[model samples]
Structures are given as structure tokens and as C-alpha cells.
Target: MSRPPSNTHDLTFYNGHWYVPSPPIVAVLMMPLAYLVGGKNISTADFSMFFSASNAVLVFLILNKLVDRQWIKLPRKSILWLVLLFAFGTPHLWVGISGRFWFVSQILTVTFLALSVFASFKSWSPWIVGFFIGLSVSARPNGLMSWPFVFAIAMQVMREDGQTIDLKKMFAWSFKSAIPILIAVLSLLWYNHARFDNYFDFGYVTIDGDPVVVQNAKTHGLFSTYYIPYNLRVMFLYLPEIHPDGPWPFLPSGAGMNIFLTTPALIYLVRRYEGRWWILGAWAAVFFNFALLIMYHNTGKDQFGYRYILDALTPLTVLLAVSLGKKIPWHFILFVVLSIIINLYGANWFMNG
Candidate 1:
């Protein structure tokens, strides 16, 4: 139970105001709804669920457009299946249900991720793409990693259209595009400065609060070689604890499963695949986020799966949608079905536990 400006997940007190390390876009967006629904009575869980489900619909619409634009082609059934899988067959269901401040960042970042892709494909406007990607980074700082991928895709699109690589024009366009993003990044820095007097501080100080995280942050400095193995376990090898005593097979607290185990469709990533601009961008985005997660001190405990990957799910799910448009070997489909069952089971167990 956090006070007025404080958050349940992470909050800092300074000069009679509560400060949260996470970026402000989610709170900014929620202000309208909070006002409408009576801020004191509104449930974050409900808002998170609504936003999470809405993201599913947004993905479906984006995918449908992709299909129409011939970026990827699939029968209507397969298209719908992929959308459903993305919506329900992931840790997002559990995270959405949790509805803490941290989960709000996750939900918002993923939505921004999808919006960036959607804008890129729809208009290829450098300004719009940069703006959305900037918003994504504002939602989750790691989203800044997407910059290279976004520009790379823009280059690829230009080439595909037989447009010459005009360095001056491109620079001009990118510079103009970056204006809004720069303003946003600066605003976040200002927010941090206003709270902690350090432009870069996200309030991860042992002196402030949250002992465990503060200690971990102090020890590892947030990212370090020490975190790799433990993170690997969280990302690829962890499993749920089995508790036989509960009415149902309730999952133990702090348990987690690897994406491969919980969402097996990622196995399809091993197979040979065609590479396009968006696909390459998607892969780049995934790799960047994974690399960041690998070095971070926190492994996102008390989760069904690595919920940190929710932000990356936009690109990852896009990759899955592209896969579906292809031949979709039997094994891939089988893995997807298996993933659905595992996630469903995991969600139910988590909720009941």
C-alpha cells in the first residue's frame, strides 16, 4: 500500500513528494482513467487487464494489416490462432493480473513497442517511428536499444523501394524525427534530476529504500558479470515448484519457468527462416533486450515466466505471426499448442496459488 505518489513496487520519498524510478508515460496515460473512475477506488489490476487484452486486439489488427500488405500471408484461422496465442499464451496474462507499478511499465512498454512497429509498417514515416520508439524507451529504458533496429529497418525499406541512399536527406529526416524523442528523453532526465539531483539516477540507492534491491544494486551496480548465470536460469532453465498440499497443484511462490518450457513456440526460432526488414528488426530488438536482461541484477522473481520479456513480446510475437504465414511445420504448431496448454496451466496455478 503506497501513499499518494508512492508505488507499491518501488518508490522514493523526497521533499514531500513520492518518486518512482520507472518512466512516467504510464502514469501520465492513466491519469485520465484514474480521474474518470475515482482514483481511490479504481483497481490497477483491472486497468492492466484491460490494457493487456487491448494490446492483443492491437496486435491482431497490426497482423491483419501485415497480411493485407503481403508482408505475411496466412489463412484467416491461422491468423486468428496466432493472435489468440499472443493474447493468452504468455506471462502477460499473469503480469496483467498482478497490476503493480512495475507491471504497469511492462504493459505500457509492450503497447508502445507494438505501436512503433505498426507505425513503421503503415507509413514508414521516420518522425512517427522515432516518436513511438521514443515513447517506448520512456516507458522502459531498455527500449532505447530498439533505435538501431528501427533505423536499420528504415534503411532496408528504402533499399527495397529502389530509393537511393541519400545521406544528407536521411540525416535531415532523422534529425527532424529525433526532436520529439530528445524532448521526451530530456523530460525523463529532468524528472530524475528533480527527484534525486542526479540526471541518470533511477533511485536505486541503498540509502533510499527497498533493502533487497538496493543491496543487490550496490553489489552488482545493476549490471555485472555476476548476474549472467542466474539470469540464464531465469530466462531458459527455471521451473515451477510443485506443491502437492494445496487443493490444486498450486505453484510455489518465487517459482519461474523458462520461455522454452512455458512458451515452446519460441523453439521455432531454431529453424531456418527468411529475413526481411521487419523480421530482422524484430530479431535485433529481441536480442538487445535479452542481452540487457542477462546482465541486470534482478531476475523478476515471483513470476510464472520471465515477465521482463513482455516488452520484447511485441517483436517476438511479430516473428511468430510471420512464421505462421509460412508453411508452419507440424512440429511448430505442436509446440505452440503445448505452449498454450503450459501457459494456461501456469496461469491457473498461479492465480489459485
Candidate 2:
């Protein structure tokens, strides 16, 4: 299934886009392969293809664990669901084809999320858990937001099994996990220092090479103020402006609306599935909503709705999968089908546009 051309301008950060510098070394570990294959100046399509492949592999690994654990079972006719979910969740159709770094981060974030959940169920060494969590943080700064949930879940696991909390054990785990994360962070800092002379610079600050202060100014103010309110309105109310060339021709634009318009089966799944799994869902939802609030407060274009928070999609999908196991009401199934149609139409419009 080929997607329609994007209307947004291509973003070429490597070509002297000062503030919009190259991705961190940690994030672009695959660039060497890309460069070798394409010899620099790789097409956006190439990048998307690489990202999609990487993401697919990671998604499969994570999903396989769930299937193995019997927490969820893949259905014979579930291929459509998988295709649709992956298509919609991918950044290629939403953020323009050039945003491969974001897609990679999303994949890494989801992988971390799955590992975190896996860790909660088993009695793993603190060091191992820390390593997974730290890797997640290294993938994207936003990974930090999920730490509270991870910690809580780990604590729950300990308490549920009647293990006394040992501060010393916890500290040891923290130190062990911190080592890998520290190395990654240090590497990132070193790259930033070498590139921009600032250890904290993470390329976002360069947004087109303007000074951080200037970019900050452009990202916030009266003009961008309505973005937050607009995002909130669309996210909860399911109203978006129609994109002339968007994924859905009949509905309002923005990807965030999909959350509300998702299949009723999924919604029911969320409502019915309660327990340790619910904790994961809740954590993802809370962090996503928090991220939306932050994005709303800040100024930036909201092209694909709440896609900036797409990193949470995997956990949400897992929750939905778990929920689908319960008896689904017929009316709810109807609602879900309708929502799927709407989402598909919207996705088509987006790709075509």
C-alpha cells in the first residue's frame, strides 16, 4: 500500500539547518549503514523504509513476549488489525516522510515500554531492570516520564510477592542501571559539546540554527498559544479540521482524534481489562496526556494531532489487545467497526493529501 505524497515541506536538517542539527550519535547508530547503502544524501523514503523495518522488528519482539506469556493471543483474522495499527501508528504518514529520527525514537520507546512491563511480572535483578529502563531513557528524553510508573510497578511486584523493600538493594539496582544510561548520556553530551559547544544541546534547540532563545520565542507566544487549547479540544472532543489532502476526507484533521474514534472493541477492552495490565495502560495514558499538556503549553506545529505522543501507542495497543479477550458487546463491536472505518478513511486522506 503506497501512501499519498505529503503536502508538508521536507525537512532537511543535515543541509546546513543550523539549529536543526543532526540527530545524536546514539539515535543515529544506523546512519553508517544508511550512508554505506546510499552514499549520503539518502532520500526521505529510504529513511522511512529503514525506520519502518526497524520498528516492525522491535514490535514483533515485544508482541511475541506478550503472546508467549498468554497475556494476549493473535487472532487468525487479526492481520487487518495489525496492518491498520502499524500504518496509523507509524510516523511516515503523519510527520512527513523525513522525520525518521522521531520514528526511531518511537520504536525504542515502545521497546522499552514492553521490557518495563515484562520486568514487572518476573523477579529480575535490579541491575537488569535498570539497564532496560536506562536504555529507554537513552532512546528519548521523554522516556523519563514513564519512570514513575516503572518504579511503581516494580514496587507492586515486590509487595504482591511479599518481598520486603530493601533500600540497599534498590540503591544497588539504581547504580547498576545508571551506568549504561550514564554512558549513553555522556556520549550524547560529548556529541553535543563537540557539535554545538553545549553539553545539553539536543538538536531540538537548534530548530533551524536560530539561537536557543530565538527558537524559544518562535515556539511560544500569542500566535502559538491556541495550539494547546486546540489539541485538547480535538483530543477529547474528536473534532478536527478537515485536511484537503489528509487521511480522512469526511472527518476533521489531526491524529489525536483517533484516540476517541478508535474501535469500541478497543475501548471496551480497556474498560474490561483490569489488573497489572491496567496499570500499564494507565501509566501510558497518564504520560501521554501529560505530554499533550506540555505540548499545548509550548508552541510547535501540531500537524498529526497528538502524534507527538505516539510513543505510547504500543502500550495502549497492548492494553487494547488484553481488553479484547473479554466478552465484547455487539453494540460495542459495531462502534469499533465504525471507528475503524473512520480511521482508515482519515488515514487514506492523510496519505493521499
Candidate 3:
């Protein structure tokens, strides 16, 4: 164990021990499977199937919840269409296909976020929803921002079912929900202290990697506004490259693509959506995640179509479903199809290009 490994990219050496700079939740989840499969025999690609399967099933459950709770809502055709769209039309598909360490973590992060959202809508125990929230944040610290949306949905759904959220019950539920999140936070703090002798430093600036990235992290420090312009450019403005020599008309750059360009169906979000109080919390969650992502030291490396958007995808999809209601409009179908086609290329690029 004391012998050093050859590859040190993103690995840190401190006090005669080595550590990797990543959240360990998803890796920990995979350890049992790895052991059973004789670890070395398992291909990395197989690990990502966990996310691809989870995303498809979670989309079905989230959409079906509307009908399960009350009204005999959308037809089978519409539900199937949405499942296809969600599985193909967003970063979810490509990220799972990639299965790089960062991308795999995103897979689990998005999965837990969807589970947390579903628990809120299903009006499961507030404790369960909070547990999922803890799981998400443990996967990626940014996921902590989504707890507001989950809590609001839980309270509002209970009220809709005519269960009173009296002050006593509210306090009790809040306390219960907060427990898991508190535990997750404390665990992370302990991990950081063990690794770096600090409660706050997750060691991004100290991580070893590509020279350009190292310089940027060292120059501006992590989470500086100085990094916002490049991040915004990649996340929103960068488009398909018009290549002069390549046979393909447009080349997919490693730089991320515009969010709306990738998923045009989201344009409908500009229209008047239903006036649900809890949706404010969902939108708040999206904005909060976006603000932190854009200010981070790096946009992303070797990505297609703004992978960071996965952080807010659950709340955004919840808002979009409410906005569209039961009817599948012609324009909505057109946009979703376009979004799927775009992501088809993204998935191809991620796997083979």
C-alpha cells in the first residue's frame, strides 16, 4: 500500500499517503459489486449501466406519479414519449455512456435528486426524502442546494391531500429531515480534515492535473467570479463548431454547448406556467445551482452539452411537466424530438468521436 501508483493525475500525495480528489459516495456504492465480480474483471463501462437504467425508470415513475396520486392524466403515448425524451434528449444519456469518474458521480447525483423529488411528490416520509437529499449532497456538494425544493414539495403535497401542516408537525418533520443532511455534512467535514487537515478545503486547488487547469486554479483560486466568463461561454454561448476541413458540417467541441440549444423544449419555460407556490422553491434551486456552477474554477473537461445542467435537471423537469400539463402539444413534440436528435449526436460524440 505504501508503494506509489504510476498515474497521479487528480491524485494528491500528502504525509506519505495518496488520495484522489473526488467525492467517494458512488465509488463506495460500487465496491460490493466490484468485489463480487473479482474487481479487475469488471469493465468500467458496465458501471455506468446503473445510471442509464435508473434514469429511465425514474422518469417513468416521476411522470406516472401525477396519475397515481389522483387524476387519470396523460395517455400512454405521451408518457412513453416523455420517457424517451428524458432518456435521450438530455445530458443523462451521454453522461452515463461516458462513465468517467466525474461523469459517473453525476449519474448517481442525478439519480438521488430524482429519487428525492419523487419522494416529495409521492408524499413519502419526510425522513426518506431527506435521506435521498443527504445521499445527493454526499455525491456532489452542489446537491445540497436542492433541499429547499424537496422540503417545499413535501409540505405542499401533504396540504393538497388535506393533511394539516401544523406548527408542531412542521417542526418535527423539519428536524427529522435535517438529521440526514447534518450527518452527511459532518462526514464530509471529517473527510476533508483527514485528507487536508482542514474542515473547509476539498483540495481542488491542490489537485494535480493538466498544466492549464493547474495554472487557472492556482491563479484565481476556486469559486472566483474571474472564472465566470469562460464558464458562461461554455455553458450557454458555445455552439457546434463550423469546421472547414472536416466532412461533418459541424464539429462537436470539447467546450460545452448551450443548454437551450441542447434541449429546445425548455423554451416553453418562458411562457406562463401554473402558479404553484412550491414551484418557486424549485426555480430557486435551479438558480442557486447555476450560480455556483458558473463561478467554479473550471467549466468542464471533455464534455458535451453542459453536463453541469444535470444538477438542476430534476427541478427543471418537474416545473416543465407542470407547465405542459396533460396535453402533448405539436410544438412541444417537435421540440422534444429535436432535443433528442441533438443528444443522439452528443452521445455518439461522447462514445466514439
Candidate order by decreasing TM-score: 3, 1, 2
On residues 212-302, what C-alpha lDDT tens digit does candidate 1 reach at each position?
7578788779888888888887788776666688665646335356787778787656645577766777788888888998898777766
Q: What is the lDDT of candidate 1?
A: 0.74
| Model 3, span 242-345: residue lDDT tens | 87787555676676788889888877777675556467778889999999998888767667788888898877776676677667788888999999999997
Point to the candidate with the largest TM-score.
3
Judging by lDDT, tell me the better candidate of 2 and 3.
Answer: 3
lDDT of 2 by residue, 220-299 (tens): 63124446665566555665565568544455443355455433334444454456633664466566545645454332
| Worst 10 contiguous positions by lDDT, candidate 1 | 1-10
Model 1 off-target regions past 4 Å? 1-9, 15-18, 207-211, 248-255, 329-331
TM-score for candidate 1: 0.87
Clashes within 3 Å, all models in order: 0, 18, 0
lDDT of 2 at 196: 65
User: Candidate 3 — worst ten consecutive residues by lDDT sum?
Assistant: 67-76
Better of 1 and 2 by TM-score: 1
Runs off by more than 4 Å, candidate 2: 1-27, 41-101, 115-132, 152-168, 201-206, 209-230, 241-248, 251-258, 262-266, 269-285, 288-302, 322-325, 328-340
Q: Model 2: how far is 87 from its true place, Å?
A: 5.4
Q: Rate the local accuracy (lDDT) of all candidates.
A: 0.74, 0.52, 0.80
By lDDT, the best candidate is: 3
